[model samples]
Target: MSDAYLVRYVGGPLDGRVDTLPGLPDEPRETVTHVHLHGGPKIVHHYDLHYALEYGCEYRLREAEERDLAQD
Candidate 1:
């Protein structure tokens, strides 16, 4: 099994939440999409990967104009 590392989400709705994701350290810095559901239409938050730490990775919220869906 692959090692699970902490993924810290900075800014946006999921800010300050650290999730355990399984992947290699050499993975590309891609957009991280998080779907939020709260009795309404599902909202997707896109974060841009920024830095890689010793035990985790940092992802910042993408600009509003670059997002696929807009927040209500």
Candidate 2:
């Protein structure tokens, strides 16, 4: 299963806010690095990858089991 992640802003005008992206990839890091090299945000906060599939199985099982139990 493909994993999902949430990218949150740490500090700045957009701080404490999460960026809802179509897809989170390493592309942002590459861009940030390039900008930094050319004089940009010195303390760039990289996107944090919060694994969405960590407890995915448990959630699926819970839903399936609930349905099965209701039929019983």
Candidate 3:
């Protein structure tokens, strides 16, 4: 079994909330499987944090639907 925390990577599916990430405009909806890490402390009000992993990435824009909200 993969030791990676698979559960945390799975979110925003079925509810159509996944449609909200940026750069997904007109793109067929697809699920992303990955992992991230938080450091120092956790903030409830904060969304995803930019943690540097040896082999990982972070988003440059608000996730899809969240971005849509900013458009207004």
Top-lDDT candidate index: 1
- Across residues 1-72, which tens digit of lDDT does each residue of candidate 2 receive? 455445554433344654444454544432111013335645322333223432221111123454456448
- Model 3: CA > 4 A from native: 1-50, 60-62
Q: How many residue pairs clash in each candidate?
A: 0, 0, 4
- What lDDT score is found at residue 39 in candidate 3? 78
State the C-alpha lDDT per candidate: 0.81, 0.35, 0.31
Per-residue alpha-carbon lDDT of candidate 3 for residues 1-72, written as tens digits (9 for 90 to 100): 322211122123222122223231343223333333387553221134234232332322237676456447
Q: Quote the positional error of residue 4 for candidate 1 in Å.
A: 7.7
Residue 68's lDDT within candidate 2 is 54
Model 2 CA lDDT for position 39: 58
Query: What lDDT would candidate 1 get against the real structure?
Result: 0.81
TM-scores for every predicted model: 0.65, 0.30, 0.19
lDDT for 52 in candidate 3 is: 26
Which digits, one per residue and each the tens of the lDDT, describe model 1 over residues 1-72?
767898888998989998886765577467778889999899878899888877888899988876745544
